[model samples]
Target chain A: MDATPVPETTATPDTECHTTHGYISDKARYLARLKRIEGQARGIHRMVDEEQYCIDILTQISALTSALRNVGLGLLDDHLKHCVVDAAQLGGEDAEAKIKEASDAIARLVRS
Target chain B: MDATPVPETTATPDTECHTTHGYISDKARYLARLKRIEGQARGIHRMVDEEQYCIDILTQISALTSALRNVGLGLLDDHLKHCVVDAAQLGGEDAEAKIKEASDAIARLVRS
Candidate 1:
């Protein structure tokens, strides 16, 4: 394995110096999911505005929360598969930082 | 305690025949919070559209999810304080159904 980091000049303009993150490969899919999530949020706002039943509103909030959770989990999976794996292959302080960061994010996800 | 149900004609129009919910008192506040949540969802969608960093996006998603969770919890609390209490006072199948509904909603919140 080549230990040498790729030169910044050779890196793609879209990614800059930092290597492309894992989710980029599924960018369109993520955007579509987020779009639907945004619509769900808007729908909730409208429901509240219209004075819908509390139980019904709560149900919608649960659904939205679940949707967001799924998105978060998907992103985490991609990050682990790509970014974490890449860092591990390189093997150093960067790998440790990446692992720690991922762990912290996982904790937040769990606790949230 | 007056076990007699309030006459439908005497009940307030805003609540119809049903008693006013606990959250009704804080309706405006809930609406405001939901509006902000909607904006947060939109912001997340934009971040993904712009291809922001995955970790940063995850952080925002966490925050959004937490916000929704809080709203769900608040609604549940209100439901318990008002709807469930009312049902319990009535003492029948209605009470059992209310308790079951509340438990189901709580489970959804926890799993989400």
Candidate 2:
């Protein structure tokens, strides 16, 4: 027997995993938002470097942090609405497992 | 002024926004995992209800929390690798915007 054993396959059947055109568009939109934030981050960096007002820099940082959390929460919402529910519908351990996984993740997000 | 102002047209061109077959499958898998966790959560609840040891309940909760965070991180990873990167390649402000958004979210996650 080959020393390199094939990993046991999970409940998931092998299927295509590419993002759909629609998902791509949404992603594109999300990315655009991210890019702007990136610019803002760079601006923050510059402000820090230039010894700008501490309060102003801190304010920007706070906004930046909030913006990031929003993005994460939005994505989490989408995943639950789409992925977790769908898996549950399929019936079996896979579905239940998925739900538990999501709940756990949500719990973490909340705590975080 | 009409109370419901038409939302400002953002850069995103509205398109069909549904998860593709592949994405659906992945989602299905994730959900299954979540369901298992749900059972675990319920078990934890029961343990608490029954007045089992506090340490045990706390331990289970901790494990559950960790599991949830892992799922979130996994989803986030996939989004960045696929969605965010794809948007950047398309050019314009969109790409940069997406990256920044993700970075902010990451910062928050780390802090949490």
In the range A1-112, model 2's lDDT, one tens digit per residue, is: 7565788743244221122322343697679878988888999999999999999999999998778767667666455434543443454555446544544554456565
Best by TM-score: 1
What CAPRI-style quality would you assign to candidate 1? acceptable
**lDDT for each candidate structure:** 0.74, 0.61
lDDT at position A105, candidate 1: 77
Clashes of each: 0, 38
Model 2 stretches with alpha carbons more than 4 Å out: A1-112, B1-25
Worst 10 residues of 1 chain A by lDDT: A2-11
Candidate 2 CAPRI grade = incorrect
Worst 10 residues of 1 chain B by lDDT: B2-11
**Candidate 1 per-residue C-alpha lDDT over A1-111 given as tens digits, one digit per residue, 9 for 90 to 100:** 322122112112332215678888999998888877877777777766766666767777888899899999999998888888887887787777777778877888888
